[model samples]
Target chain A: MPDSEGHPDFDELELGAVLTALADPIRRQVVAVLAGEPDGTERPCSSFGLPLTKSTLTYHFRLLRESGLVRQVNRGNSRMAQLRRADLEARFPGLLALVVAETQQAGKGAPSVAGNTARAPH
Target chain B: MPDSEGHPDFDELELGAVLTALADPIRRQVVAVLAGEPDGTERPCSSFGLPLTKSTLTYHFRLLRESGLVRQVNRGNSRMAQLRRADLEARFPGLLALVVAETQQAGKGAPSVAGNTARAPH
Candidate 1:
């Protein structure tokens, strides 16, 4: 597993890449979950319970990390992911909030691919 | 050129599609330019001066219009485009502002494909 060293520096975060990484419904749901967590809290990738294969989840996490939206670190045997909230807020103010808001709205209104129902216990 | 009838309504604007449309640097540049204009101001598609073929520019504008980010209307032989500021603000507050701010920052910094230099007089 690659380490946080691969994460883009705050100054290196590009708006286009970040937005592109976040354009997916699943990715936005993952981001919304991380955004809802208490500050500094890190959760393992499995904790998301997204309706995706393990490899697909891994791909999503890698995209998130490379886009500077999330930071991933090896936690024992699990890979823990944390939103780079402060960095994102500083780099693209109000962007994260909108993601969270939109995700929540989607979760409430429709049965989207990334909606809460999609995360039902397996 | 299709009329605004093909445009997505405010309620039909999906976050994923909107973000996907905005993910491109060229599209972001167009949004930034429209955002900077006075409220209700509309500009013809050719006015953007983007470095792209006519067909490619049409594709970008279509994506923008279909995503509900920009509204386009047939003005004689030319199509005029305007940012759907009010609808976007009502649907995803702060998102457009972030787009504008990031584009401005990119414009001032390194020369990017969507930077101000790319819009230099042809």
Candidate 2:
């Protein structure tokens, strides 16, 4: 049985972290795929098909998991990921809807480039 | 007349930039205040009461403007800021709502700290 040992609790999920994690195009693409799946569906790490190296993909998955956006569990020799849809909806309602909507929009030929590169103000 | 010269067009507003801009707590607070105000209500930059230095605040405002989350225009001696609610709603539905909701939730005594500091995967 997979235990939720490393996942942040629902209350521990911060808005900034969630937003930051979802800000990446690749992470958002991963989230979009997860959002399309049925509830409680667990996908192997290799199932994402992201155009990146294995190490880069691993990093993205770790960020998503740490941000409380997705839950990852070790299954046999591979890692499985699942979007914490219910937890996210309970904490930040309508957030996933926007991600899914944006993904759909991008899929309809909208460019997914980050046009604005405003530096973070310290 | 306030011309939208520096602001990105609705189509040019990228999800990553918008999310990156909103990921900062200070910027999100500014957006939350604007969301609470009436439609088309423009407030001077000094009205936000943020703890950041003047330069830092200005940077945040500029980032928000560049990201298409807020519009800043010079009104006489002061720079006034307004939430581009309509534009955001049209571009990414439920996005501003999530910001507003998160703000409200934070205001309800939740700690608004960015607990998850997972580095951005490049």
Measured against the true two-chain complex, the DockQ scores of the candidates, in the order shown, are 0.53, 0.51
Residue A27 of model 2 has an lDDT of: 90
- Cα error, candidate 2, residue A110 (Å): 12
Quality of model 1 by C-alpha lDDT: 0.82
Which lDDT tens digits does candidate 1 get at residues A28-96?
Answer: 888888787677667777776678899988898889999998998776677777899999998888888
Question: Which residue pairs collide in model 2, if any?
Answer: none
Alpha-carbon RMSD, candidate 2: 8.5
TM-scores, chain B, all models: 0.86, 0.84
Q: For candidate 1, lDDT tens digit of each residue in B30-91?
A: 89889988988899888887768899999999899999999998888888998899999998
Considering the two chains of model 2, state its CAPRI-style docking category.
medium
Quote the positional error of residue B75 for candidate 1 in Å: 1.1
Question: What's the distance in Å from true for residue B18, model 1?
Answer: 0.8
* lDDT (CA) per prediction: 0.82, 0.80
